[model samples]
Target chain A: MTTFETSVPAIEPTGSLSDSVKIHGLLAEFETPGDILKAAEQVRQAGYRWWDCCTPFPVHGLDRAMGIKPTILPIMVFFAGLTGLIAAFVLQAFTNSSGMSVWAMVWVTGYPYLISGKPLLSIPAFIPVIFELTILFAALTSVFGMLTMNGLPRLNHPLLGNDRFRRATDDRFYIVIEARDPKFFRTRTEAFLESLGAVAVEEVQD
Target chain B: MSSIRADQVGGRIVDNTTEVPGTRAPLVLNMTTFGQVTAQVAKVSEAGRAPLAWYVAFAGSLGLLGLLGVCVLYLIFTGVGVWGLNTPVAWAYDITNFVFWVGIGHAGTLISAILFLFRQKWRTGINRFAEAMTIFAVMCAGIFPGIHVGRVWVVYWLFPLPNQMEMWPQFRSPLLWDVFAVGTYFTVSLLFWYTGLIPDLATLRDRAKGRLQQVAYGLFALGWRGSNRHWHRYERAYLLLAALSTPLVLSVHSVVSFDFAVSQLPGWHTTIFPPYFVAGAIFSGFAMVVTLAVPAREMFGLKNLITLRHLDNMNKVILVTGSMVGYAYSMEFFIAWYSGALYEKFAFVNRAFGQYWWAYLLMVSCNVITPQLFWFKAIRTSIPLMFFLSLVVNVGMWFERFVIIVSSLANDFLPSSWEFFTPTWVDIGTMAGAFGLFFTLFLLFCRFLPMIAMAEVKMVMPAANAHHDEDGHHHGTPAPATGGPS
Candidate 1:
């Protein structure tokens, strides 16, 4: 209550855990994937939503830890492929049949173009290009959509600022209980993380 | 049901049988390193001196290719009258070779694209070489058509343009379609093959000892990094290309088939050509794959990568397609009998029991009969037998085309127009030269290119099987499962 006490950076009482609590903006390292997963599960169970997992390689069930759903890439690729099929079919048919003025000349020339009594606009004939277009479109969608969804071409990140995060390219795994999570209290979250087998717990600063 | 042990100890079936003196339970090498991996692969070589044989075969092929060059020169100087190609039979050997080469290219795409889509993992071992064969074979196939037009200089006329001449390639013509189909196929297959090579090129670049090697590989690699993001994009692109290629493969051959089928030529005017040609294409392609792979496995020490298992799988494909081709043969005969059309009946009869009956029988024996042996596992698994069978398949496939082209053209409805067409020295030389061209390029590709995809192979290692193996390990834990904080 005194002016000197306010200037002295407000020392907290030892009895009150909340008043004595300290928050560190850094993620703790995990010695094994199991340790990281345990922490992630505890955080998830406690109803903390804002969290992420980073690893050297894609770790199985990491998506579950981060509460991430399956990607819409397959759907996007399917549609893109469908578009390709349509484009190829239409283009080939038009060019082969109606688009060219050669039909009129052939009719007049009387060159006897008949073969096995098959019609001009054959479905079997067009199948090849149609199939080709489907693949072309789907593949393009997969490549482009994957890039766009990942928010790639990013030259910098908050994780890039940390030296410890560099080990994400090696044998390290990380589970960050984000500040935005509702259950992320400064002291309680750290204590909870320590209890869930995290080797060290620190807050990640943005 | 087929247990060797007669007695049991406790609850477990146990045998107190002595190990056979000669058979020490077949010591399977625990492949732990790349060097050991190479050693295991080397052991798969049925012939230790095969690499030396490869050098001799390559040298011989190169010589033949050179002889083909001389023949082409002779033809260029002497004009169209060098040998045969008189009047109605003008297209003979040139067209046959063209069709043959184009058919050869089909196997590459069928092996690479369709097989890739089906998740046939065995394809990974042979697809690379098959693709290389496709490209080279196509190159050989393309040359005949280019030069056969007489004025090889004016081949650009195939390309549609609003030029000073103000003419267009006949859009209605199947030949024009052949140009489009073949051109598109070659371009797309080239891109598909190159895209797959980029990552492998990067691997080679890292391993290169010389400055030139590094620069060459680096250029081809396009600065590929194994970043997961890059891999994600690359894999998607590759899948798309493979998808594109499946249709492209079919179209290329169908277009080639149309060259014969769309016309009112007696033997060629059938609706079954597309499927028939596709089956034949795959049949021959598998044969070529076997031909190249059997030798390549022995020479490049890729037996493990291109295992007996892979060969067995390819042999199965060959058998299925070969049967389809054989079915086509039977159908052609049935259609001839069923249609009651004099020309169709004559064409079919002429093809089988006609003047070129030997050619027809050769085709049947090679394409139809030999592939049937694949039904037996022992025959399919035998390296020497499969090699011989592959060669037979290739020869039969060639004869099939020969019978189709020569027999039909040699004796058509009008006897005056029908002439027995024989290949000239030039024709024989050029075809032989194309083999030379294929081998020269292939030999270089083998020496230079990272023939095996090391990165891809590495990705398939036990370490990469972590997820799948976990399910396996739940039943058998040799060590305390490392499933906790270390």
Candidate 2:
């Protein structure tokens, strides 16, 4: 019976830094994947750890050039799946197996009943529920793990302000070295990117 | 020209002009550059409006959806008695429809998950389309079971939540397993589908001209910037999810089969039901995909992207799975006669020659006999013939469920309860309306979203700009040595 409206504040590009808007990074556009890969290798060798290459699709070997390490998501999923399997077994056993309990008087939480002369705690019957829960937990872990690792749901990023940077998802590739990086200098980074055959270099404001 | 020996062609270095023996057809036809792949797919979504045929189809689907809504409301007001369910045949059309729709949902996961694990690149072209179909088919499947409970408002009792009565769901019941299996299947499927759609949504967001489109597509894109670091982790997560989904696909249908196999009924109790049902599910699911893709590719002018090769591959799958289903049918009869139980023997015999003989004959003709035509290359390659055969498979699959449910239940072991079962108008109306719901959702998807996976199709193209050598000299060119081996 209620509705809520959440709107993202519009990003305005003024080409100047103000209190509310500071230089977030320098974005360089490359016309080809090879050019971007060459530039990324240079950036990595130049010891810029906070830089990344963006492409329309996953450029093979670009991860090696950018020096990104493998993720630990598979381990997280495995543990989450194990937790689900154990939890399902415990839940079923507690709910279906009758045992004496100490309350004000002796009572039983589980009212066990027999069907087709099977045992009260049937592991065979419990297997399906366990399997389903395992998958459910593992799947949930992977999706949420991905989102958290990617720092998503922030709803806003400074790179989105630049119109030319939008081509990162379309037909162009980019290399952006954040302003927060230790080795980054606006003019020097722009010059380096240009030396690596960047067609355009622009500043991203926060 | 008279007789060029193998040694004459540079000794095992064959010329480019000569055709190689037993070489497979190219997965992607009309090899184009990366930018062209983007432009071709993006143009469909970027077009200001859909074509006239799309509008016409959408309108027709909406009309059927409205009819479905009416039938559902009427069914809710009146009870399950409005269906043709009687003493012996209580699970007639509703259960049949539920099983049929659920079976139809299996092919999407098979293509997206199983084929991906095997490194089949051809699946990239049509995986998105099939996955969407799976979601919609599951939606239709969920409806039948939800409404069949009669007291729809109390359906939450299916879950094992704490209540004032202090009673829990019977953990021993396969029906309860159905709840969790299908529930998890739907959730994971939706997550997988949305995850795959994110990059494409980002592409749509960047290309959007209007402010509203930008905000909507941007919200779903979740600020995806195509960073190499993100893609690295994203690819790992995608593969892990695919591995998880592969087993989920087998488990979901196996649990559905458990709904029957676990029971003590004469015809329903069998060990073969799990694999038989899974094979049938993929068979029907592929049929539904072909039924949809043929018209969609033609109408959207996507012949180059979804080529004849894709259709041929799908037909091959249908051929294999259809044969598996046929084998299961014969094995069921042989086992029934070999069991030495009078009830089981009569169950098999009555299915083919008893009161519901027509349903059995139709199921056999449509499912087992019709699909064997795909063995001919000419029949498989012809567009119109494949489309018609796909529809026939659909009809046959529906009757297969009908025969399994109705024929078994129409005559029990007790002679006192033997009777005939028939459907009421409401049964027929509701079944037709489910199609209305399916097509309505599918048409909306076609109109609004990118039907084909654009980013994926680009990855498979010849000119996607990958570095093949350490020197980085080799880029976006086919390797010369690739023709030497398989």
Candidate 3:
């Protein structure tokens, strides 16, 4: 079979890379959000770009402590909502007022009917659908934009496999600094995390 | 069995206003650590077997849901004539049920969106449950309109789409506005609910012992690592959604009102309909929230989180909204008389003394008179009385829609075509079946997911406000309280 012929050569390259299991990151567990809040400020000052703190809930001032920039999501959502509003108006205006025909499978012509002597292009009447579309677009963007920015729906994360670090979602707070960060040296960073009073620090495997 | 879980409060834990002699009670009772919050909520979902009551309730709900399924099939196969719809009363039970269920969905959004904007930290306890109720109630509401169309397969025609018929949905029509409004509402509510669930799902995913449980929870959890970067954007998105939803909550019911108000029918053609309908929606929605919450918190041993304060607060909302609804009812009659229009006067007068007088009487007595009982602190806090009153309010609300829709349609201007409307067995069964669908979804949500928003709850506790530098916890000794539930 063609499958058997291609498989023999592909295994050789993967076998060479198997022995050196590269480190994904290091996790430093904190007993309290307060503890992590203090350490995050230190880490932020140290200029480690590839690090993130983890908590069970949204911690007040932790973003500032970590020097995280305020998200631009609201600005984007506003524009997305605006697009919905304009699109609704255009769609309604063209279909109900203009003698426009658009092709989808076939040319579908706009058919406007006189009902209760109401005008065909009534903006007042069209407002509800416009308003609803605005909301629909903004809401969809908010959820999807948040997910996209977070790089979520990731099937695996290195720290999820770590036992003690699993408490990040339960009660404990964690700070993980990736090994790929420029300032990251295994010993020095571990010592720095320990000195900042991490209750426990563990290396995470990729 | 009492207000406090007596066994859990070992003097160190503050259970209530009366728990400790010198201190005021905390919002969360008999708890000192974040771990305790996680454990309390997780235990409910992680239980090997649900309590006896769960099985009993689920069986009853599932049975009714089956009734709904059968009724839908029968209606589709046999046609829409299975219901008691006559020529004049064509919009009788179906439209009434649609409005009733849609109105009941309002309270959930009000709590989740409006309360969040107001910075009501106490909403943390019950917002998730209320939002779940909103989604399910909307689902139930959606069914009525979809089936009432008679031709189930052609429901897609409601949307503005390119078709061989060469037609577009009339955007100018309030009915078409309703399709978009309700559809958008369902989509937004689902997104908001799912957004709230991700972190909690991660919590469930982490704690799951069985392989199947782990995989199922993990997949939905989307491999959430509780990263603060994610939470930062997540929180921003939540705020944006809440802000978007606030006006949306108001708009949905208002558009529903437009469905009637845009018409020229005497009783239905009123400018006051939007606010009146929205108030009634909140009234009935709050009542339904209590109707579900009282049993749910008790059944799941979640009394400490969803405490008497939460119930007391919800009853307060019911009382305010109920009084508003009563005022609106009286105002309608006044406006009718003030206008001096013959048909309007007859519509209001006939609504009171017509064939549907019994329905009007039940609405007034239950909605107007029952919520007045919540004025007493003892009554508001009393579990059994509030529970009973909530059910009455729900019944009163359902009848309110029935009277409004049927009475007006029954005695229209073309009096020769008018007729007294009555529900057939199918009509009654389908309405009851909607409740079955609602409860079936809710019971499953409670069983499989974190019924309480544990993450949000922990955000509100006093411990979250601690500043390590100021508190001198800087050297960071492992606080014994920070460990997992002991």
For each candidate, give the TM-score of chain B.
0.87, 0.92, 0.93
lDDT tens per residue, model 2, A1-206:
11111122447454433424557788999877678877877787777767778888888767766667668899999999999999889778877867534331334376577888989899999999999999999999998898889887557777887899888887799998887776777678889888889999888865
The residue-by-residue lDDT of candidate 3 on B1-486, one tens digit each, is 012232345345532423455433456877767889999999999999999999999999999999999889999999999999988788988999999999989988899889999998779899999999999999999999999999999999998788877778888889999998899988988888889989999999999999999999999999898888899999999999999999999999999999999999999999999999999999999999999999999899998899888888899999999999999999999999999999999999999998889999999999999999999988998999999999999999999999889999999998798898878889989988988999999999999999999899988766665462253433433222211101
User: Could you give candidate 1's per-residue lDDT for residues B370-430 as a string of tens digits?
Assistant: 9999999888888899999998988887788878877877887787777777777887778
Arranged by DockQ, best first: 3, 2, 1
Residue pairs clashing, model 2:
none
Q: What would the per-residue lDDT of candidate 2 be over residues B1-486, giving only the tens digit for each residue?
A: 122222233223322222356543344555445566667677877789888999999889888888889888888998989899999898989989999999999999999999999988889889998999999999999999899999898889998765656577899999999999999999888888888888899988888999998999899999988877788778888898899999999988899999989988888999999999999999999999999999999988877778777888899899999999999999999999999999999999999999889989999999899889999988888899999999999999999989888888888889899878889989998999999999999988887788888778777654454542233354332222111001
lDDT of 2 at B224: 86
**DockQ per model, Cα:** 0.08, 0.33, 0.41
DockQ of 2: 0.33
Docking class of 1: incorrect
Give me the iRMSD of candidate 2, please: 8.7
Put the candidates in lDDT order, highest first: 3, 2, 1
Report each candidate's C-alpha RMSD, comma-separated, in the order given: 10.5, 7.8, 6.4
Question: Candidate 2: which stretches are off by over 4 Å?
Answer: A1-21, A99-108, B1-25, B468-486
Best by DockQ: 3
